[model samples]
Target chain A: MNKIEVKGLYKAYSDKGRRINGYDECRLPEGSTVLHDINLSIKRRSFTCFVGPSGCGKSTLLRIMAGFEHPTKGWVFIDGMPVNGPSPRHIFVFQEDGLLPWMTTRENVALGVRDIKDSDERRRRIIEYIELVGLKGFEDHYPHELSGGMRRRAEVARALITNPDILFMDEPFGALDFLTRLQMREEMINVHMMFDTTILFITHDIDEAIQLGDQIVILSERPTNLRADIPLAFPHPRDFTKGGLAALRRDIYFQMGIHTAL
Target chain B: MGEDGGERKNGFMKGALSKCRQADRILPALTVVVIIALWEWVVRIFSISPGVLPPPSRVAAALWGLAKSGVLFDYTVASLFRVTWGYFLAVAAAVPIGMFLGLWPLGRAVFNPIIQFLRPISPLAWIPLAILWLGIGDKPAVFLIFLAVFFPMLVCVMGSVAGIKVTYFRIAQNFGLTGYRLYTKVVLPAALPEIVVGLRITLGTAWLVIVAAEMIAVKSGLGYLIVDARNSLRMDRVIGGMVVIGIIGLALDRIIRRLETLPSVRWKRMQR
Candidate 1:
């Protein structure tokens, strides 16, 4: 069964009137379409990557599915129920620093599960997740005190500790330096393997898409629609240097209108 | 082997931290001693009139006299009481209202302009109105101090609340937090560092206004002590009063600084 389904989703922003020739003009708000007719379903316990150029509305589509945004047309369903608003069942990791600065690592990870009445159980799970994210000794450190990669790990732990059925990340590793990015990617795969939670990750990096995704959804430029949905049946820890992945990479670049050297 | 090395590292870190803390205290005390010595030298070298600029020794004598008479303690208590009540009251009243204004656009639109207009008109200007409205006593003085703190606290807290990154709210929502939980858990903590900064600045202004307010509106505070000493031509007492005010202001500011450094809010000053 599909974990999430998006059907004919559309989103648009209305630009407020701007001054022309130094005169205050009352122009009608004109809609600039961001996503057009976005349709796809993410399979259960799958890692799906939405790859596209910058400003291609992949994040918008992710937000709409996460229920942080509303689609101008069409619908999203989580387990056959239409998504009306944000639910704890789905956690969305923002691209920016989402960890509350005032909260320590333990507090940030524990915040989502605060509703749990059992204090001992809550503390135990918070510790477990902190250890899972490799933030064992830094539980008392605030987000600002943590390095970029550690902050991202804390954010991911915060999301996962909730044990949501699906997690949506919007270019989560985009801000990290190269070595840290590689380390975090390894940690992320370990986490996915452990939790087995379905994930929908959005990124512009084609290499990242191939490295992490079991299924890659390619998106077109502005007024974005799905250009392709390619599924990989390869096992975990696949070698990127293999002939098959190289061919796949060339195909994706071709789909994105880039001619690869291969 | 690694465990032993880690233990040795921890011991070294503790020793270094203690040494640094000692330096922090000693440096400030040394600066004070140096300043007093310079003042005593300058006064003697210039042969300045005692009425114009009394030596530090004379101010110390005057301070000792006040302490022996118990008048210094009384005046300190009076000023401290006014400042404490005024500061707490403004915080209590303004924080909730600021949150409301920050969250709700209509409320901000309606009241912001009025607050902006009132904020710039020095709270000293309210002395006449505070006296007329509340009558002579600690009440009028307290009112002026409250007025002095209220607007700045309100403006800063409102800005802090409004300035919260939208992404945090989305994260809060994603966690199923709404209404009060959303605010107390996410919004409040996120905005707290900025709010503490606002509180810290307004505290200095409150201390400043209390002295001025006490001089005119009340008859028994540090401000009154200074004014009374001036009228009696006791320059030593006047300088002593000034010294007491400076010390109290510095102490209050240090207290706020300590609060800002608490583990909960210290993220505002990330070393990086």
Candidate 2:
């Protein structure tokens, strides 16, 4: 069953009788337009990735899905209800950790759970998630003491502790080292597997798009209409060093406008 | 110790010891000792009158006399109370006002010009008006202190709030914070350091303004004591009161600086 659905999606910003970023000019001749009459459904517990370059409005779409920004003329339904704003049930992990400097790792992970009924239950879940993120001994440490990679781990751990039906990650591993990025992708996939969550991950990396996405949605330059949604034939626990993964990487690279070294 | 280990350890210790000495040790304090020595020598050489300029020893004697009389404590406590009450009033009023101004464009538009216009007027200038409006005693004294402290504090809170990085806001927004929760939980805490800095500035301002207020508006503070001693021709008591005021001001600023460096706030600073 589709856990998340988008239909006839349109997002435009207007102020002082001027359209935001000249998006009105990008609309085609038909009823369809840029971000053009989008229709797509995300399956339950599927790892979906959106790939596009900078200024492709990928982040804007992600923000809309997260309910930070409202769609101008379309609808996004979460669990069969239209999204008004970010609900507690749908957790989001941003590219930057955004961990409160005032909070400890344990507290940062447990911040959104203030509305949770049971304290003991929340504490146990927070601890479990913290341990899952490999930050067991550092639970009491603040965000300042953390390295960049550890801060991101804390963010992911915090987002997961809420036990959302869908985890929205906007370029979560975009700022990490290449090796750390690979490790983070595997960790995130493992997390999804362990928790059985639906993920809507957005990034510009084709290698990353191929690696973790079960459904890779490619977006055009701006007024980002859905370019392609390719399903990964590569199974879980896919080996990066293996030749099969390299070919998949090549296909996505050529498709996304990068030339081969040869 | 092993051959290389001993040398490395010795070098490390030397570096650590020197840093501590430079940062904290008593060499800097030697400047104070030298100044006092020079002052004493100059006074003795000039044969300065005890009535006109009491030597440090005579002033110290006056401090001892005042301590024994229990009069010094009463004046110090009274002055402390006025400063405390007035400083808190300024903070309580200014912080929310500053936050409103900082957070909302409309609030900034309304209040910014008024505050800027009033802020330039010195706390000392308000003395006569404060006495006339509040009419003597604690009211006038507290009013002057408030006048001195309010602007610095308001600016500090506004500046601190303004100083928050745009990244932090975007990050918080991404995590689903909006409305009041965003201001209280995110913006306030993020801007806390600047608010602290303002509080320190106002603490000193309160101390200063109270001295002026006490002298002209009220009659029982360190400033008044100095005035009374001048009339009585007890130069030693006047010098003693001045010393007490200086010491308290220095101490309060140090305490404030210490509070600002508390571990959590320091950690927050490092993150920024």
Task: Using lDDT, give the best candidate's number.
Answer: 1
Instruction: Kindly give the stretch of ten consecutive residues in candidate 1 chain B with the minimal lDDT sum.
Output: B263-272
Give the clashing residue pairs of candidate 2, or none.
none
Which residue window of length 10 is worst by lDDT in model 1 chain A? Answer: A17-26
Q: For candidate 2, lDDT tens digit of each residue in A101-208?
A: 877898788765766789898888888889989999899988887877899999888778777778888888888998889889889878877887899998878768
Candidate 1 TM-score, true structure as reference: 0.89
Model 1 fnat?
0.69
Most DockQ-accurate candidate:
1
Model 2 backbone overlap count = 0
lDDT of 1 by residue, A1-262 (tens): 7888899999887745222211112232357788899899889999999998877388778888989778899999999999988988788887867788878899889876877999999999999999988899999988887888899999999988988899999889999999988888887788778886999998888888898999999999887899999998877677767789978988898988897555
- Candidate 2, residue B194: CA error in Å? 1.7
Q: Score the docking of each candidate (DockQ).
A: 0.43, 0.23
lDDT tens digits, residue span B78-171, model 1: 9999999999999999998998888776798899999999999999998888889999998988888788889999998888888776777787
Residue range B63-176, candidate 2, lDDT tens digits: 999989998999999999999999999999989888877766567778888889999999888877877788979998888888888887887888677657654565566456
